[model samples]
Target: MRKIILLLLLSAFISGCSSLSKSQIETVQQFGEVTSNFSAYPSAIMEELAEIRLKRGLYYASTLTDPMRHLDELDSIYSQKKYDYKVSEKIDVTFRVLDKYAQSLVLLSSGDYTANLQNNAAEFGVGMDSLVNLYNVKSNAEKLPAGIGEALGKIVGFSGDRYIKVKQSEKIKEYVTKADTLVLIMTSNLLEYLESSNLEELISYEEKMIRRNYLTYLQLTDTGTFESQREYLDLKSNLDAAKDLKALTIQSTKDLQAAHKELVQVVQKKQKLHSTIKELRVFYQQVAEIRETLNALKKDK
Candidate 1:
């Protein structure tokens, strides 16, 4: 009777150990999977965000040269209304994707946790509640700005196509500043997450995206064709500067701070470029209106 009891006890202990090991493995695997998926969300969002910013910057630059010219008419346009609408639509699409992704993550994590718990009935396990909280954090982060881009699209009206000369105007500058600030916020938020996760590969990817965005902005602002040596040189210089900054090693806190400072400078430059474009746009519109009036008077005569 004593030997039989000892054998039974040993079997139960072995089973408990096996159950615990399996449960731990499941938790780690689930955590890794979720975090990896979560990391991709910001990268996707940033790509769109960068494109919007660059487009807006180019539009502003073009408008600065000719106040009478409308953005839609420019070879490269910067109509807030159009951009905003597109951004809004994109936001809706992104939100839906995020919603589905979050839901799936929750279901998977819960299922895994539940199965593990059942297998180890004697021990308390990490609840699905914690995983739910993680999903909520990611979802909220992604959902907040989907509508703002759309709202901006509705406010700007059609101006016409002409090469607007760059002008220095306060109101135009203000709008540019506001738009650039929004972009900065988006980029900063993304960088913060990447930095926190210490994911070097993702950080490198983001840096490349940022550089591409800046290059697009430069291209839009340059009015002279590829044939214009001056314009080409200017564009090349800006591109090189942007690329150098992007490639710089940022391994320490100091490096990050320096990089941030540079980013601020870039935002300021974009604001200035936009301001110049806006002034030109307004000027071209005024000129075109005058010309139309003159032609109408001639016909009346």
Candidate 2:
């Protein structure tokens, strides 16, 4: 009878130790999904910018008096553009590493703790360092804070250690507290890059150039040819699509930041995530709209 009572007590303790509620698990899973999807936006946006530049160059080359004579200069331009895209790819990879870290949090909630998850977390830290180095070497903008990379690595690595030592509910609260800072840094840097860089400027400039290009042609030919008008409308449509996408991407980033903060509060304070989950849903819808815009642009191309 003493053995039976002891066994019952042990079972209750085990259950109590592992009591990550189903709702909490679902919340972490949704956070992982939304963040991972959002992380890919930078790469997609960079590709879209590259496409716009390529089209603008081709159209301008067609109008040149001697396009063949400037082939060497155009080649140089293409090479530089390719290099820019490479930098963007590194940025994309870094964001993905953060996404991976978020997934690790989900793993904790699901109680599927991996023995080697720390290695994956360490890799993400290394990726963050590499990203900062690439940006510092290639960009003239103010360098990112020197400690930001190391700090992210440490937080992520520590979170892995805590996951193994702590109960799921406690680990999540601690992880979210540390990870909220990383999320802020990443999302802020991305939004800053979009706002301060020439990418958005280029898109706006292209819109103006398109208007002028069509207007000039219309003036030269008293009757605006069907081919010219149709081409003008198509080019205008592309620019409008890009602008719309940029707006949505910026808003989505903002929503992502808010969602992460709310998640931290929900986890730490043991609050329901009704509004936090709703915000994530809105973010997902924005991401879907961004995808649809990109697909439409591709079809137009």
Candidate 3:
């Protein structure tokens, strides 16, 4: 009888172990930069609302309350950070976290997961801390890295589809859905202000007055004699340019109204996004595919 012994050895590639391609890095940077100007939109509406309320009086007079009550309500929403700022800051922080994840993935792709994991993990926690600070609800920053870890886990599994499915957890879906909801609320209020208040008329009147002033200025410049013929010709040329501003202003107001109407239609169509989980899954999968392509690029390099 002969004694027999068998042994097996295999290599496992850890996640984030490839070098990144230029396009991959650019995509990550671009994705990070794409963010909604949530606060600006609402702030603009509030400013318009306040101006119109002062110029034309509040949207409507209540049977009982301060006459500026409606304007005050808008002010309160803006000042209290109940919606606009909340939504804006929240989305911005989310973008930051995503950028961090993208960077961490790059590190992993570079075959430096274990060495960089500690510091990368710390950055993720800090990012989450910034994020949770914006919300009224509580969240542990440590909880965030777990998701990053899970995403990193996909490296070993080598299954992008499965990884995407894992990202579609209920918690993540709810967060994405709620973020979208916040935007809807912010935009809806703007449309409501436009429809219910005197903002449209106020804006139009203000623009009309501005155009009138430009015309008045043009007449004054034309009537005045210049020291030289070139001076007079230059003034005349600039006058044409100044007159064109009136047309631009008109177009700007029309464009605003068009955007306002389009937002209204979108809100009507996808009221709450009951399939929020599916939406998130699809979105995350796209991000994942980008990451995958990035890994492949680095590997080829």
Candidate that scores best on TM-score: 2
Work out the TM-score per prediction. Answer: 0.23, 0.70, 0.28
- Compose the digit string of candidate 3's lDDT tens values, residues 137-175: 332222232232333333332234323222222212222
List candidate 2 stretches off by more than 4 Å: 1-18, 65-70, 83-97, 106-166, 211-231, 269-276
- C-alpha displacement of 33 in model 2, angstroms? 1.0
Q: Looking at candidate 2, what is the lDDT of residue 217?
A: 48
Ranking by TM-score: 2, 3, 1
Q: Enumerate residue pairs that collide in model 3.
A: 16-108, 16-109, 17-108, 17-109, 17-111, 18-109, 18-110, 19-298
lDDT of 1 by residue, 1-301 (tens): 9989976885564444322122322332332233223323333333333433454345345435555554444434334334423433333333333333223223332332333432331111122222223433555454232322222122222221110101111112222233233333333444454355434453345445444544554576654455444433433443333233222211221232333333233324422222223322333343344334334433422
Q: Which pairs clash (backbone N, Cα, C closer than 3 Å) in model 2?
A: none
Write down the worst ten-residue block by lDDT for model 1.
160-169
lDDT score of model 3? 0.35
Candidate number achieving the greatest lDDT relative to the actual structure:
2
lDDT of 2 by residue, 172-232 (tens): 6665666676677677767876676587677777777766655654555455668756766
Q: How does each model score on lDDT? A: 0.34, 0.63, 0.35
Which sequence of candidate numbers ranks them by lDDT, best first? 2, 3, 1
The C-alpha RMSD in Å for every predicted model, in order, reads: 26.5, 5.9, 16.4
Is candidate 1 or 3 superior in lDDT? 3
